[model samples]
Structures are given as C-alpha cells and as structure tokens.
Target chain A: MGFELETADHPERLRRVAIDPLSRVEGHGKVSILLDDDDRVRQVRLHIVEFRGFEKFIQGRPYWEVPVMVQRLCGICPVSHHLAASKAMDVIVGAGQLTETAEKLRRLMHYGQILQSHALHFFHLASPDLLFGFDSELSRRNIVGIAAAHPETAKRGILLRKFGQEVICATAGKRVHGTGSVPGGVNKSLTAAECDFLLADSARMIDWSLAAVQLIKQLHRQNPALYDNFANFRANSMSLVAHDGSLDLYHGQLRVRDADGKLLFDRVDYQAYGQLIAEGVKPWSYMKFPYLVGLGEERGWYRVGPLARVQNCDRIGTPLAEAERQEFLAYAGENGRSGPLHATLAYHWARMIEMLFAAETIAALLADPALQGDQLTTSGQRVAEGVGVIEAPRGTLIHHYRVDDDDLVSVANLIVSTTHNNQAMNSAVREVAKTYLDGRRLTEGLLNHIEVAIRAFDPCLSCATHALGQMPLEVLLYDAGGAIVGRLCRASGGGLSS
Target chain B: MSDVFLLDGEQVPFTVGQTVMAAARAAGRYIPHLCWHPEFQPHGSCRLCTVKADGHFAAACTLAARPGMTVDNRTAELDDQRRTLLQMLFVEGNHFCPSCEKSGACKLQATAYELKMMTPHFDHFFPDRAVDASHPDLLLDFNRCILCELCVRASRDADGKNVFAITGRGIKSHLIVNSPSGRLADTAMSLADRAASVCPVGVILAKGRGFVIPIGERRYDRQQIGAAEEQ
Candidate 1:
C-alpha cells in the first residue's frame, strides 16, 4: 500500500482530510490522512492522481524526436528532462558516445539549470520568509516583498538566473525548451565569445552567492524555532551520477546509503534500474512509492535530494562545498548523517554547496580550452533499452526507454525524485502533526513549518504528477471520548481536491 | 531529372516524394524558416525561401525534387525573389526594423539583408495599435508583427493550445490572442511557454531580455539565420 499508518489517539478512528490543488512547488498533488479514534494518526495516503500517459504518448514517436517531445514534461526543468531523455536515446541508439568536449558542454548547460533552478527556489519561493518576516502577512510575503526588502539580493538573483538563461539561450538558441541537445551530442557549440561571457557571468555570481550564503546562515541562526525538528526523522539517502561518490550531479554511477551512513549500493549498473528498484502503485494516487530491492513496503522507504547527495558523497570536489559539508558535519549534533539539518536551514546550505560546485565545474570546463573544438554529433545504430538518471534540483530523475529497430521509442518509464521522497514526506507530515499539532489550536507558524518542511525537498509536482490536476493538504481531528474534538484546519499550501 | 546535392555535403539517396528543404535537413543541413516548422502544416505565404531548382526558380519548402536533379540554392534570380518578398513583408506589416527588438535576430531581417534589400520596394504601413503588456511574462507589440502565422501554428500544432489567430484581412489583417479581451494576461498563458517563444517577429517578446543582449550580440546577428532556406 502507498499509504502509511500512523497510530493516533484511541481505537479504530479514521478520518479523511484531502489536500487538493497544491501550489508554490509546481503542478498538483493530494494527500489523504485517516486519523485513529484517539485523534492520533492512522493511514496517510499521498496520491499523485493525475497521470500523464507520456510513456504511452511516446510509444510510437521516433527516437530522435523524444527529446523535443519530453520537453513538455515541465517548463521549469525542461533541461533536465531534455538531457535525461537525450542520453537515454544516446544509449539506445548505441550512440553511447559523447566527446569529452561535448560532455563538458553538457555540464555547462546542466549548470545553467542548477543555477536558475536554485535561484528560483531560494529567491522566488523560499526567500519570502527571510527577506520579509515569516509572519509578515501572507498578502505581502511574495517576490514583490523580496524586491522591496532586499532589493539588491532579488535583483542579483534575477540577474544570476538570467545569466544562466543566457548560457542556455546561447547554446540551445532558446532559454526554455531548446533544440540543441540531441541523441549523440549537442546540435550547436559555443563560440569563444559566448564561453567567455558565461565564465565571467558565473564568476561574478559565485562571489554574490557566497555572501548570500552568509546572510542566509545568519537568518537560520536567528530563527532556530522555525526550523526546529525539521530533520528529526532520518531516512536512507540515494543519489545518481556521482563518480567515486563525490558530489557528482551529471554523469557517473549511482550510490545508495543507509541512514547509518553504510553504503548499500555503490556504482550500481544503471541499465538494470527496474531490477534494482521496484515501484509499488496504489489506487489512491498516481505516485508509485519506490522501494529498495527486497526491502518490502515501509522497510525500503528512502529519501533523495540535496541532503541525500551531500550525505552519500564522500567529498565534493569544489572547495567551498567541501568546507560547508565539513562545517555541517562538525555541527551536525553527533548524528553526522546530514539528517539533523533542518528543512529551512537546508535551503541555504544545499543551495550554497550546489552553487559552489556549479561555479567550480563551469570554470574548470571553460579553462579546458579544448572545449572550443569540434561540435560534431557522432552517431551509431542500436536497438536496445537504455536508462539515464541524473539529479534534477528536486532529486534523482530517471528516464528509461525501449526503442525499436526503426529508432522509434516503443516504451517509456520515468521515476521522478518527488516519487522517491513521497513516503518520507508522509512520515515527516505525521511527525510534524505529532510534534506541532497536539490537537489543540492550529497556529499559522505550525502550518508554515509543515509547508516549509515539505518544500525543503523542493518537490516539483509537475515531475511527480505528470498530468494536470490539483493537490491540497487538509487536517482533521477527533477527541478520545469518540466525540468530534475540532474541525481540522487546512494546511497552508495549495493542493488538488480529489 | 538531375541529382541535387545537399549543403551539408551529404549525399541523401534522392527521394522523389520530398521537397529540397526536407532532403537538405535529412542530410543534416538545417534550413531555417518562418513559414515552415516540422510539426505544422507548410504555408509558403512567406516566400523567403525562393531557390534555383534545376536551373529554375522554386520555393524549397513546397517544391519537391526529382531524380538526377541539380538544384542551386544560391543563385541570382532566387535572391531577387527573396529580396522582393522580404521588402514586401517589411512594407506589408508595420516593420519598424530600427525600433524593432527582432531587428537583428528576425528571420525577416536576415533574409532581407541576405538578398541585399537595402530599400523598401513598397510603401511602409505604419499602423498604430495598442501594445498589450498585460501578459505576465510576455509582451505583445502589434506594431511590429509580420503576420508570419508561426505563432498560430505553434499554438495549435506544437502545444495543442491555440491562443493566437490572425484577424482582419489583407493590409488590415493583424494577429490577435484568442480572447476578445485582447490582453494576454487574462487569457490562458504562462511564462516560458512554447506559444510565447513562437513569434517570429518582435510582435511577442519575452519580458526580461528586451534590451539586455542588444542588437549586435543577438543569436542570429553573426550567422545567416535563414540563409540556407533562402539559398
């Protein structure tokens, strides 16, 4: 079952509260909770009701056409979907070939996504609380507030995001759903002028990002209560494309580790993803709760994202990210699993770490000089199944496809990051209720904490739900004497009422 | 019938059913276009791609090649047609090329220059229309539209969302968003969407980068953006 049972108050007590029309993240999702008789907690079902038949949609589409087609997945993370889908085709077409320069170029494009996405997450979504007070009236707390409160930060974040956009705009000819990346390699290569511009822009952003990190860190320290119990529950972590388990975001092997920091799977064969990971589907939602091999049900539940990647990687190559990781570990309250890090705090730390790595990687690539060479798209013929997995800002995004002899995609499957973390979020929500909600009064701060904790994973519901719908979060309560205790106040975020 | 060689220098075993443009792209030669998108039905309303096919003038987008066909995409006669078409489009719509954001990167501008269209052959239609800045992340400047119908095709074909359509007729014809509200803000639109990116001219512009990159540093400023098709 996709639902998790939480022991609430008394005897067989179950009440359904559905969160419909989920907002702030992307797309839609709904969560239904069944409360026990004592108003404690019963079963929590996270339903991804809307299903996009993309797998069926792409069945007859030519392999070469998959990239442009899959770009429809999400406007925000189109690059990730584009790259992942293209790489999957590359493997299927036996075009398992990308020049070293092409790989670096791909990384350069990927870095654009990293910068833009993290900026959007930090500035557009989460920064409202920091720039403006958390309780600064819902009507006033928005991107407009950030612009008014810390005008320079908002302006710089926007500029940085545009710089990243320009990098994509330069190479792919458009910032959004670009037609540059193809099966074997990139369609267009960057000129010296473009590369120079990208390098210079990224370098400046790195300076701004470091200072911003400090500002965020200070804010985190001031509001310890806001982030309390954020990391109380620790789950197994997983990340893909990290070579030698060192903060690799784009291309390499995958690593899965237990909560105790023990390596469960290292550099596992990506082609056999179906065998290694199994998705359990429930009638309640479209989101398939994925589990580790043979872990069965709740036993195999795991989490993946920035925190997971940082924890699983032995070291991040970049100096700043490495230092931050060290600092986080040192002050991690003895758990040392990157687990105790609060959701609100994780925003700045993970963002800085990612920013540091993004800058270092792009700079290294630009300095390589050979990246200015041939943009030839080497091709090959192949008829095999291929799987490409990369960490989008959300978490591990996997694209698996089977192609026919005619080079048309016959079958497709995608295991988005949000899906992987769905179960973990359910557990977190339960814990949040138990800790904050005490069945008494619903404070806006508690509601904000619940929403912030969920947003910490930076869930991209468009990637999760795939189809169009809404996701809403509702809360209900009952007294121990089998009497209605209180009307469940709704959680402060958007959700689709299903 | 003579064999036509592709610009990419690939010898695509001549197909009798397809146009020269198809053959060229199939051979890895990309021919840029305004009226020709792969997913949309072809409309040769924009005669920007006139080419010499087997010693005769032909539009590559609509003209299918034959066996043993020797077509010259770069020729004097075809270049003249391209210039005339571009100049006509310039004068046909309110193409304030100087004030236009699409000046450098515009396919209309690129083709006009490629054909050495130094002067407008016809009188320019300086039509006055209201600018719709209502859309959240996109801008609509009706004064700069070329009426290429790319936006229409993009909305209907690519995204399955037909948010744009051409209204009026002849010189009076202009592109309009789906709703009579005439404001993209009220209509169904999103930032970073395919419809927003489809406009060929400065009629629709992404809000953020209006004057940032400037005219010279624009993407198509360096290369002959629509040259291959013109050739």
Candidate 2:
C-alpha cells in the first residue's frame, strides 16, 4: 500500500514519493524524481527514511570506543569505516601520527579490502550475466552458477578474496571487524613469520590476478555485443589523494579534471571541498546532488569510481601495477582525453588494474619494519575540526567532523564517493533510458540497464546511506498542481555503518 | 639485577620481569607457542613453548629471566619435546588440521612446523564435539579445542569478562560458556571483545565470515610469526 509519483506541480512539484523494497540491491533505498507539466525533472527528492540516530546516540560516550562502535556499519567494508572513523578521531583527540611502517600497514589493509570487495563484485555478483547468458533466470544467476560453470575460476576468485581478507584480519585483529587499528598506530604488530606468510601468499595472488585479468578479457571477447562494448557516457572526473598531482588512493591531494584533458583543479586542499562543491537535497531519494560550488544545482556532470580515478591519476604507483595501467591507457582514448571510458565495461578493466596495484602496494607495506610502532594512540585529547579521506572500493569517501575539547563529535558531515557521482549517475540512468528503455514498460532489459548504470559507479548504499539500524524507505508523490498522487513505504532491518 | 645469557654466539643482558619467551622474541629468536598468546596469562597447555632453562624443559612464556640462568631456545632436546607435545595435542582432540580454517593462523601449526613435526605419528582421537553456530557472528566447535585455555584467559583477563570456563577433569576437560544457555552464540559478543578473536584453534570460529581468504594465500601460509623475536 504505497503511492508512486507519476506527475507533480511547478515550483513546489513534489508533495510525496514512494520507493518500495528496491529489488536486487544489497540493501533497501528509495528515489523519486519530480517532474513538471512537460515531464521535465523539476526537483529531486531524497530522504533517509530510517533513522539509526547514531549522531544522537553517540553523545557522552567515551571517545576512544567509536571505532569498534562504528564497525557495525557494513560488514563488507569494515576497514573503510574503521579507518575513516579513526582518522576523524585522530583529528578530535589529536592522535595517529604513525610510523612509516604503521602507514604502510594501514594502506595494506585498504588495498586488501579493495581487492576483496572488487573480487567479490566481479566473480560473484557481476560475472553471472557474462558467464551465463544475460537472460538467465534470477534464481540461476548467482555464485552457484559461477561455481558450476567455472569452478576453477570461481575458486581462484574466492581464494584471492579470502586471502585479501585474511591479510587484514591477521594484521588488524578480525577478518570482518578488526580492532587492531587504533587512534595513533596499530595495536597489533606483525611478527617476522606473519610478514613472511603475507608476502608469499600475496606474491601468489599477483599471479592469480593476472590470470583472472585474462579471463575477464576472454569473457569480454566472447560477449562483445552484450558485455564488451559498454554504454558510453562522458563527464568531469574527481578523485582523492593524488601523488604529485596524479591519482594516489591512500594519501594524495584531490584532483578534478574535465573530459577534454584539461586540468580543472589538482591537489586541491581537502578543507575546500564545500567551497569547491555544493550539494542539493531532493525530496525523492536520500542521495544528495553535488554541483560545482558556484554553478548552483546540477550544472556540471562529474564522475567517480574506477574510470574516474584512472583518468584523474597520471599513472598507477607500483612498478608491477604500472603494466596494468599501461594496458588501460593503451585502449582508452589518448593520455589526454576521457573519451568512451565512462561505460560499465571500463569499470571491470579499471577494477582489475586497481586490484593488482592494491596487492603489490600492500605487500610492500607489510614488509616495512618501522610499522611496528610502540604506540597506536596518543596522549592529547584536543578536539579540532578535520577531514579524513580515503578511496573506498566504490570511490573517494570523506568524513569531516567537528568536535569540542572534550573529544565529543559536534558536527559530522560525510561526502560519500557514490553521492559525488549522483548527477553523473542520473545522466547515465537517463542515457540507459535513451539507449535501452525506448519508453517501453520497465522490461527486464531496461532494469538491467538501470542496474548497469548504477554498477558503473559500484555504489555501496551502505556507505552512501550512513544511517544506522532498522531503516525503512518512505516514498510520496504529488501532481503538477501539488495534488496527492501516490506513496509507498516499508520498514526494513537496518545495519550499522562501520 | 644484571644477568647474561649466551644466545647463538654472544652474551646479552637478561633483564628482570622479562619472560624467557619474551626475551627470545626481543633477541630475535623463534620460540613456538600456542598457550602463550602475548596478551594472556601463561597456562602451558600445549607445552610446545618448552625451552631449556637451567638445563631443563620449561615453558618459555611463563619462565622468568633470572640472574645467571642460561636458556637454550634452539636445541635437539627442545625440538623433541615440542614434537612430543604436538603429538599429544594431535591425539587428544579432533584436530583435523587439513579441514580447519585456522590451519594457517593456528599456533599449533606454527609450532609443529618449527619442530619439524608434521605427521601426528599417533592414533586420532576423533572426538564428536558439538558445534554451535548460534551467535549472530561467531562459531564454537568444541571438538577442535585443545584445552589451551587461551580463549578462557582472553575472555576473563583481556576482555574483562569471563565468558568461558573449563568443565570436567582429565580427558573430559572441555570449555563451556558461563551463560545458562551453555552456548557461545547466546553471549553478548561484539567484535571488539578480545574473546571474539583470541582463539588459538579452530574450536572458536567467527560464523558467516570464513572462506573470504583463500588457501595458498592465507596470512600464515609462508612465514613463522615468532621469528620476529630474532630481529
């Protein structure tokens, strides 16, 4: 019993919007696009229906306990939550100046997560369509199908994924939600034996990944019509942490570039994100629309995730990973132009390249002896405003927190990587509509197209939607004259954001 | 008091309040142990951490560095003792090391390999222990427990909450949660709880969260962690 908004009024177009248990996604969410008389998108509505109320609940709590407390966000990317929260706390408590070894260990964990999550994406979730025909039934379209059809490849994927997770668990404390990382440095130190084990396995992982890259290429060749050539969309690109004005995932400056090889901005200070970008809140979806700071709402098209990071960066960092980067650069438009790299097909290629870089980079970090620091936290508890930034598997994630001297969080703002691409996502969603929808009733192909558009950014709703616990979706819609049209709402089991 | 021990070829100061195992770790030596987690009290359950202290087999983790006390962490007798201890651990529990998820990270595996003791060389106990998958995020398989008491120590001391306790005697000795439900799944376990990640064996597993890291690439597949003590 929910209402669907078909049409809405001018100026105050949207009165209500409804989104049911959105199908086939990992979590639940809703989106409503308000339209004018001519059916042009007038206002975008976004509302986080369920309230985890973490902001309210976390008050007066011991400040040091936030990392473990926040790890409940998403099981898939607990490290991201742990690191982001820890970094934020570092700003609050004035801590976490880790040794070279500590920094390496921390980056190793980030790489481990990147590899594990991307492997899960390619092998379990996305590969089914390519391996089996795209038209395969929803029931048969799963990891089991991948296992039955290509056991070796599936096993390889599983092993690499697990290995990445195990590396983090071994160093951090737990596989899903490790506590070894603290405010200052890591609580756990690696023994020589542990280091050797990680090194040997990661070496093997490099080889296995190269083989998988070949498999992906083969799959691309096998189904070029359906899978190889992806829908093309072009836009401006942005990424966090660039090494000397190039893309560096762990610690670099933020870079934004236009589609025509023109550098819009490079290594911009993190504190200037708001001054550089502005956000628009719609009454339809909970997603925030970010536009160029002064341009006002949705004026510029921006993209993030794999393709954007690759294009924004000058080159991949690691020596071994450089080869993969070369391969990516070889195929895409010249070193200067963005070209047709915005398609979903490009995400797979960029994902594999990033996987190699993560493995190699993490291996180097674990081998660093200085990381075995004596302290994981510091003494001072000076609260300050700070921003913690990291490139999540999906894209760049930022956590900006304002706290008082007591180290209690005062104001918290998050700019998720997925939300940064909201305009680009809507553009692609409409592009998919132009390419496949053809005004047909939402067919399976059309739905797949929409999924494909979202998948290009590899949106992590858990990260994008940062509320915690028992969140439900509520949608309301109204007519052009501000008349009630339709509504849909339902409650769901909500999870914590790590 | 200043003391010294001839390690490898040179003499080094033996400080007070330092366990022989910790000294060995600090001096950059490998002394394998399962019941001697860095954060827990010593129980010497597995007995693989045995070192030659004062010309006798002693658990390095619990033995203090004393004035004029000589310790040999690497010796033929100590190797033989570790092998015997591993053999006993192998014959006493349902340690199907091959199928165990903790095979790589297991202290037992590290100690066994360090002592060159691969084949159990004993009859399998094959105890049919109950497995609990009741917790929202952890697993407990009693069959695989070697009675190291690390989990108990981790729960009681490190975590400041005694979630587990030992029951029965001798061969009947088994670990049990303190809850009336007698199940691990029923406990209030957050991932932050040391007990959640402190198990040295596969007996206590985190449920719905294994197989993410594949074999040939496990965290401990290649190197021994204790070797860091040497550096």
Candidate 3:
C-alpha cells in the first residue's frame, strides 16, 4: 500500500510509506509513515479504513432490537455490546434499576466475556509476540508456535478460554451471539447444573489465571526497558469504578484520571456521558477521537482498556487481583505520587490481573442464591432516549439511542472501547516510529516494533474501524531522495516477508 | 409404499412426489436448507439445499425424490456452492448477526454454520433498508430480509390475509405489505398470525417479545436447527 506524502519542509519532494493490512489484529487497518526531504520522520498515522455505518443504518430500527443488533458490531466482544445496549434499553423501558436476579446474571455473563476475551488476547494473540520475540521468524510468533513450544501453557490458555466460553453459553444461551440480556432484565436464569459445571473448574481456572499473571510479570522483569520505553507515553485514563472506587467492569459510575493520577471526575452518571465526553474527528481515519469534555481536544484525549482500567480504579474488589494490583502500582510509584502507570507494555499485566478478578467474581456470583431467582425482567412505559455504558474487555463502551414515538431508533451513537484508545494508539505509533525509524534502514523486524506497540493495546479494529474486509499489514520506507527505498508486507498469517 | 434411495451411502426412504429435502428430513438426515420450512410449501428460493443427484445439480427442496437416486448431499463441491450462496445472502442484506434478534435461531445463520462459511468472501453491499414499526405490537426490520418468501406464503395460505407479498425481481426484489396504506399498521397482521412467526430471519418480530427466550435456552442454542429432527 502506498500514499502520496507532502512534507512541510519539502513540499516539492514526495515520500510515502504504508502498512497496507495490519495483521494479528481484528478487522482491517494500516499504518502510514511520511518522511521529509532530510530523511526525518514527518508524520505517522494509523488509518482504520473500514467504514461501519452502524449508527446511520440502525436509526429506524426499534430501540428494543438495539441490544441484539449492536452486539453484531464485533464478534470478539459481542457480549460487551449486548450488555451495554441492554442497559440503555433498561433506561428506555423506564427500569433504571433491574431486578436483583437480572443484574447479577448480566454481571456474571459480562465477567465471563471479559475472562474469555482477555484469555484469548493474552494467550492466543499477545503471548506469541512476547514469548517468541518480535524479531523472531513470523511463523514462530503466533498461537500455534506457543502451542508447540509451551504445550502445557498453551493447554491452559485453551482451557481457560473454553471455561470462559462455557460460562458465557451457560448464562447467555450461546457462546458468540447469545440473547440472554434484554431491556429491563435478562430472559433466562442460571440453572443449577450450569452453575455446578462452572464451579467444578473454578479453582483450576483461578490457579491457571494466577500463573498467567506471574508469567507476564516475569517477562516484564526480564526486559524492563523494552517493556517500559516501547511506545510509552502518559495520557488521561478512563474506566468504570464502583462508588467506593473499587474496580467494577459491569456496572459503575464513570471516572477519568489525568496522567498525573489526579481525578478529573468521579462517579459521574453514565447517562450524562454526553456532557462528560465529546468526540473529535480526523480526516485520516473512520474512527473518532473521544476526549474528556472539559479538557478540549488537545488534552482531552484519553486511553482506555486494561491499562487504563487498572490505573483509574482504586482497587479491584477481589482479593487475588487486589494483591496483584498493589504490586503492579509499585511500578508507577506509591500512593499515586508518580502518576498513573504509562508503560504501554504493562497493558498485558493489567489484562492478566483482570482475568484473575473475573474468575474470582464468577465464583462469588455462582455462590449467590440471587443468581438462580426467577425474576428475570421488569416492564414499564418506554422512554424516548437512553444511554448504556460498560467496561468491555478492551475498555469503556457506550451505546446511546433516541427512539421516536413509534419506538423506532431515531438517533444512534456508539463510542466503542477501541475508539477511546484511537488517539493514544496514534501517539504510541508516532513515538515508536520516531525512535526506531529516523535514519535506520526499514526492516521487517523494525516494522514489527511498530506492530508490537499497537498490539499492546489489543485494539479490535473490527469494532473500531468497522470495515467488512481483511487488511494485511504493509510497511514502506522512503529515503532522502523521496524514493521508495524498501518495503515489507505481512502475509495473511502475519509472516513478514519483504 | 415408501421408496428406498441411497443418500450418501445411507439407505433412505421417500414417499412418492416428496422432494429430496422432505425425504432427507424423513430419514433424519439434514441437508442444509433455508426458505424450505417443513410446514410451508417448498419455495426453493434460497437454493441452499442444492445437492448432486445422479450427477446433476438440483435444488433438494423442489426436486422430486425417485427410487435409487443416489443423491450426494455432503460433498465438497455442493458445500462450496451452499457456502457461496450463504455469503451472497449475507452481503445482499445487512445480516449483522450480533444485532439480529433471530440470530441464534435464524435459518440462514444456521445454514452458514453447517457449511463452515468463514468470511462473507465478497464485498458487503451494505444496503440501506427500512424498519417498519408502525404496528404497535409488531416490528419489521426489512434490512435482514433474505427474500425467503416464507412470510409471503404463510400470510397468503395460513393467515389468509395476504398481508405480505414479494415485489420486483433479482437484486431489487423485496418484501412488501398488501395494505392500502403501504404500512404494517394498516394491515390485519397480529402477533398471533402465522405470518408473524414464519419469517426465518429477523424480518417480522413481536415488538415487546424481543429477547423473551434467554440466549442459551433458545431453540437453536440448545440444538442445531435439524438436530431434533435428526433424533
């Protein structure tokens, strides 16, 4: 892939570099780098080419169909969309608070989603790069290679993912596109057998989850500089936190923390998200840049997902994860002195801790008798507008809908988790490209360093970019003469062949 | 008397005048199908059930079964065609599974799973369609319509109201209402009508009844579409 580059200093000279289709990530996207006549990096942008006009097309559909419809946005995080939309519907239907049974069941399903999604991201997607090294042979830097090299670890990963999927199926109805959550409440309750089946392996899942956390910690210990300095930059962080400031992925108020760990806002009503957040548009990408409302575009942009979640929250409710959180914060400094953790690579560590918390949360929910209650839904007069927000495995996900008197959706807006990280991802790519690619010859391994930076966020381009196509990664190099000096393309399976 | 035929090396029985799809269903074999509901007259519009019978391609839902036909239903060549058909149907309409209320139970989605169709394999048409919610008790999302014509037949024959019909042809073809007002609100359609439930996709849905069955316990979630019939 190629694009015409016009630099400020050298308007006459043109240089272009492109990564056509970024691999090992969900959906289609590419990275473009522009160099000036002096051979200095001029600009770096991650372009999301897929245009999913879900907002425009979903306008006329009934608000009740939203929860099910929006989940189709991403296969990887359908449950997040499902729950977020359902919550919005709950507001539309005038049931601001769900029945105890419905709330607990939805929370259980969400945790299962987070658990499975994190397991997949860590074991299947991220581990290959971390374990095999970014510069390793492309063939050896994937889930299959992990399976071959570390059989037991791979097995645990698969089983962990299976357990999470089983939990989702047990609660929601099906693994992928479950229909369990609805407006005002859930449609089904957990059967005793389903609960028992999950509990049977809960202990083992927890053990394996802890081990996974330890593994990431060890990886970080081995290469502190690489993990810390690679695309590391400070920015605002956002997540949902319980009233007590405990981590609450499923239900909580919105909280935003500046890079210095200062709380900009806390316990803000999610329905009031419009007042707290505003989106900035860029000509280059389909994804919108969302920033905190009061901060304006320049400083308002924030990071979400695992790292942001762990940094923004005070403590995780579960004991094991809370312990891990304490240890993780040591890297950022004690008592919030050094500000929120900005080490981009530490996202993997934060993800593992969340996995542990999900397992523990699942166990606690299973033991609650409320999970089996028969009250599945509440009914009331429908309202005209509603907003739903939740912490997807990636980060804070928002769904807002306005229905007409006919109950058809008249206006729809969604800010997915990856969109929240769009600005941060671009900043990270710029940093990595500037540090590694200024005068050095572009190589496959060097290009991979950029991909590695993007991978740390575990950005789901499908949800973020919304293209209904495949995009393979390509990297182009330009010399001072404004000519294509070198090129690298990623095959479908992520092998970097020049 | 039932006539015996060899289907994929299994001895299967078919009644005279019954189509291959019906015969296969009778023998507890599932040839992937959409728009060929058992209760309705065979439409054969979806063409998903095309199987090789005696070295020729024919729609299983319409082709009459004969004794010793030696039909090959599960061959790679036929599956590939079915996969292609499913992909085309996916791109033709906005069949976003995650947002579809009928997703788990939708016949088109189930057929795609049976055929192992991975990607849409073609550019998405991303067609713009309308959602008719004028009817207080019913919601019709035309975006997901696969043009199966099951609703057309069910409305005409079973409900006897002629509330629905197909208009246009080829890519321009779409489901239309029969009322003078050109809206579902003016039609005699009700939640109790057979046409309301006949849609295999998310075209016709009871407005307030969405997500009535929790995801895991839904019809297809418990078992594959034809799994119960297989048993």
TM-score of every model versus the real structure = 0.66, 0.60, 0.80
**Candidate 1 residue lDDT tens string, A1-498:** 223354334334455444444445666765555554444445544456567777886775456657766867777778888888878877875677687767777778787788777777777777775667644565546677678878998898788778778866765657986666777777666778877877776678777667666677667667666543453566777788465668878877777787777788888877778767889766566777898875666777788887777777888887876887787556555443344353534645667678667766767776677567675466576656889888887788899998755444678998888889888776676666556654535444555545555666677776632221112344444444445545534334322121
lDDT of 3: 0.85
The candidates, ranked best first by DockQ, are 3, 1, 2
Q: Which stretches of candidate 3 lie over 4 Å from their true place?
A: A1-14, A36-39, A137-139, A334-337, A464-473, A480-482, A489-498, B1-130, B141-179, B187-203, B215-231
RMSD of 1: 15.9
Assign candidate 2 its CAPRI class.
incorrect
lDDT of each: 0.67, 0.65, 0.85
Flag regions of model 2 displaced more than 4 Å.
A1-24, A30-52, A95-97, A218-231, A334-340, A371-383, A464-498, B1-231
- Candidate number achieving the greatest TM-score relative to the actual structure: 3
Q: Who wins the DockQ comparison?
A: 3
**lDDT per residue as tens, model 2, B52-128:** 77677778888887766777766787778778878888788877553355766776776677678868888888776
Worst 10 residues of 2 chain B by lDDT: B207-216
**Candidate 1 CAPRI grade:** incorrect
